[model samples]
Target: MNRNAMTYRLFPAVFLLASAVATAAGTATVTQPEKLREQPGSSSWSIMELHRRTTVRVLETRRDWVQVEADGNRRGWVREQSLSMDAPTQNAFASPTRQPVGTDLPPVPRTAPRASNHALLLSLGSAAPASRQDATHAAAIARLMGVPDANIRQPAQAELTLDGLRKALVDLDARMGDRDRAFIHVSGNSTRLREAGRCSTGFTLPTSKDVLTATELAAHVRSLAHRADKLVLLIDTRAGAGACQASEDTVTHSLNEGKSRNILYLGATQEASTTPANSQGGLFTQALLACLDGRATLSAAAGMPTGRELVDCTRTTLANHPGARPLVTLAGNGNLIPAPVMPRGDAISPHALLTALHAQRDERRQISVNGLRTNYRAGGKPMRFTLTSSQPGYLHVVAASNDGFTLLYPNQIDPLGRIERTLTVTLPAQDNQTRPAPRASQSKATLLFLVTDGPRNFFRAGLSRAGAFAAAPADARTLRDLPLEILGGDNSPTCTRSETRNLGPSQLLLCSTSFGSALQEITETP
Candidate 1:
């Protein structure tokens, strides 16, 4: 056909396309097993099967079929009868625990014993030349990982040569096991570590020696494998194409060699990258510090962070880098408590405590975790919070229970980080289901709320990879699965259990900073 003739022939289809673009768009759920036919009619060849409840965007409509796109791709026609355009009020896919609106949601403490619990904190690194900050950063991380200052082997800050790295690794291996002994109980580890007492000189090696070679790192792994019940190795170093050996390869090999699956592995970077540097320390190391200290604003029912939680939470916040996802290797149950939630700053702030009460023109009654014990019987009414703020900002909630402290609000949903003047949240009481052991005595826990001018971007950014987590309300199961501690301690009888030990007043630590926080002490009696 002539060019003029072809132009006229295409006008009708072009007009239809323009019309579809000018209108509003909505999502349609596929009602049944149907074909994404090339054309709207049944005679057209089928492209693929469309399953039920699949959200498809509506584009244009014909007499009996509608053209839609599934998951932003694969355009085709679905019978008009097979598409539901109405908004779904409940979950697109049914969940087992689906109940009422608020009841279904709002689901969901402690320190570890000092002597028994132990960790082998090292700056998993290369024979790369060192900086003063490097040595200080390694020691700082060891402390955050709950390694007693006495047990840490300080590497020379000026130049960490290969031989020095080897000696440190060898000394670490010695402390973890004797000539005949491979594994030790927490009680034994406590004694051995205390006796060792900063035995590592933290000296730099001469320039000639090479360290962190794959073979040597592997040897260190072999010796220490299955050496402790609860072990955490924080690798804040380079992970090149194969340099920073991840938990994947090392952990699996250890398990095969009769090592405990109880180990939780965390690395700062992957593949030819250095742990990004920040003012306080390496960016990733700082994230780990924030998570361990409870400043990351993540909480679990289990009192403190689980191995998975620690890795996941810390990696999540470090997502600002282009290739910033850190490696988190969880073996077996993967619920190792790396540290306790020790909130820094005074838990009680006059401005934060009074903001809610003053909004009602009532006398501001201040309370703190140590202020007063509000007691209630187990299985009674759930503890409720009526939080308010005169100023506009985001609201953060964390509680210290029999398990450890963790973040409560802003779990995937509420991304805006906005809060109302007043809102009510009902927390499940001390039930046998989540809280630790015999609900026979009065149990006490504390809740801390932080009010910030804008979003706790770190918290939200860290949890971004957990798709839909931001949209759903916090629940018991979610708490348990959280790579960190969500539910309080599972309390299973094992040398190394799911959660960490209880926190004492001595363990209360701080994060980098907080805008303002309010603390509440809740006492639940049997």
Candidate 2:
């Protein structure tokens, strides 16, 4: 609640400079895009981003953070380098009391004012059973943004319909009248907005017609979007195939009237993306949540995912599911999601986090989640095995099929514990598709491990000891739907040092390390 338009957009930019250069400089012009942050550090969240060549009058300065004013409310801190110190020469002699001949007033700084000061997003999930997964994902995203759990809307009501959805949106609109930078994620319907093809698979599967017809829903969304500075409408359902390919037309129509603000529209499939009522989440929603989970390398940094990267991550992660095609539409260049903020009283600072990250990378290299070759199994047995580790670390194991991820180690029998040297565990038997089983002679799985360096329970978010992941409808699942934060967080016990060599890919590397999924394998014992 003590949040401000904050970010250390200056952190990386200012890290290289000395204190002397941080003095209050003269008015300047922005030579490149500049992100205004609320605080003076690199890890702070960005409040507003100004484009290249924009001009501003310098107001004050702090270490590498320069406070500038382009207008009344457009005042914030940005890194000094983002602006050109050589502001357009202004006549020093010119004064309001007496102007010199041919005196030229400084041209108005080329700045586009923001629509609002703050943003309040609501992730509305369909109360229907089939749509619960979609709502679950929306809630996860809201959680990622550090949005309070109370503000996030879920399908808790006995009956869910279109009218209820509209009323909710209407109430939220009234509550958020022209607030700045408000971001919202509504997960209910899917559409390729251009063709007006909408499907409420998650909603209808529960055996109720959407209170609002497709047209009415679109109209309602447009009306609500009319007030926001940025809107990210996540469609959990996918529209039926109808000559219209999975495309970025979803928000084009709804947000056209309010195009001045930024909007990032995403849906699972232009063609109906499916989720069995029992699946962990809708096909597209699963990938979306994973990308936002701070693990996906959509960008060099894990601050948050951008609109463009969201499409790329979802497309590739969901590729194996040929039927579910996720699409994206970008209305403007802006980051709608706020970077994850650590809980207060947490000692982990931005500098400390950056240091920890570098240390973790080095540790990842030295350690190994080696699938040890046992004396009993000459070639290699996927079923009978002993999984060894080079050092003490937190490990999660999963097996992947073209179908989806099946949790292995963090199961009921072999829970996620601090392993010092090695762990003796078994892979699922062949033909047992649920756990890590060998398909080819060597099935692939990943050893998703992190060195505690003696630091444990990073997020302190407890790990799941359940025997299995939440069941997915035999179809439409993507990756394991478990508590991924078990991996770690800002305040999680930190890694002390890096090891010598990193573990390489295994013959049975099933999980995609690139996508941030988890898995660890052990050679089956004889």
Candidate 3:
């Protein structure tokens, strides 16, 4: 018969529970003999019997089978009658706390100090040609983040059975030692990506039909959140336009409510092909890999140049996307702290980075707040402002500060910190400036201009030198009609104009001019 048929045939007989009987002495013997199947008596086949009693732990019973855990903590199902549950066996199995069975086994304790206190769960993508790069990057990130590969629970590809996934999770749990931190990496392949998403819901593969669904993923993740001190989910995709968005949505929608506090999502944007060829991987992915490798930090790769800069690298990454824009949204009940500001002109040492992170926690004792804000510009206009306050959540600050623009939260400090509101000050116009006549030589040239109002320091100006000024008409409404000319007999383009304004030093406002051909030149007075 086929393997499926054989597996089906074995299922019914395997789950039949054995009757439990107690002796007068309150002790019981397992009368049933554990059955070990032998290959059909073929000339080349040999029966390998495993009779060792002391090396395994019978953790749980399912129908007639028991989940047997080996000394190495490898768990698998065994026939209910595989062994005699005599008084000695019963005593041995009764207390996992007691000495484990099996004298032939290595004398070294099977239970390592690190294994007892923590557990891990891992899910790998199901796609072929697994993204080894992502796996390697993830492992590195985990290490820097304080998780070692030895503690990681990698999925076994050879074992296509659902039992494989379960065994992996169990093994990971057994190996974690004392850190109850769970790190899950979702590499390429949509199916495995989907599976990882589902695992977060609580359903295990090989599970009955009753347990398979997206809801199970969220449930599992939620359950894991409660069981583990920290749970991190990392996804590495092709960064193809909507890939990151789709994956992020899947994660958000599948995760159980209130469990998001324990989760973190990282995605890379696809790179442009036209740009100078750098590497085979996506730019963002490469940056992330560098971060994992301990060669870079999110801030550094995002252009802050150093990790000490407490800037939101996400925005920078998005800004760098070739043809598309990237946006990162943090939603959940947990506090979002602004990473510490990187010291100016200093490379971020690991010690300094950690110290900054720790400082946020320390400051939290003094304040409590939570806030959320979205920062985006459309048509050079800024709009849409929303804030939610929590006594002990996050102090969301959205601004273009000198410290390289960022939206920060006091995560290391109190969650209930309040961010100052943005102040908008309109500059008064300068009426004393006279418009210069259009220069005859300014036409047919790309205009480089700067426009700002005069007195209050807000004015607009334009310039061109390739042709006569008549070629470029200026509209008073849009400043397109501004005169363009070369001043002081210089072959290079120049413009001069003077404007008077009444404003106090306290009211002065400084803003960078928009960089473009239009801002190339401004006619001004000597």
Sequence-dependent TM-score of model 3 = 0.33
Output the better candidate (2/3) by lDDT.
2
Candidate 2 accuracy as TM-score: 0.36
**lDDT per residue as tens, model 2, 283-347:** 66666555555323244222223555566766766674545544544443333333232221222
- Total colliding residue pairs, candidate 3: 75
- Cα error, residue 285 of model 3, in Å, equals 4.7
Full candidate order by lDDT, most accurate first: 1, 2, 3
Q: Between candidates 2 and 3, which one is better according to TM-score?
A: 2
What are the models' TM-scores? 0.35, 0.36, 0.33
* C-alpha lDDT of all candidate models, in order: 0.42, 0.41, 0.30
Could you tell me the C-alpha RMSD of candidate 2 in Å? 22.6
lDDT tens digits by residue: candidate 1, 1-526: 2222322442335344556644735557565667888899999998767754445668888999898865214578889999878442321111234435533211101222122233333332333322223334344344444343224444432324566556766666655421111111100000001112221111112343333333344446555644443345554443333222233343334444544443445544333344343323344555655465444545443334465666676666666445455544444334545553433332322222223211211012222222233887666675556676654445666544544334556544444446656555544343354444557678666555665433443232122222322211233322223322211111112211111233232221111111344656667787
Q: How many backbone clashes does candidate 1 have?
A: 45
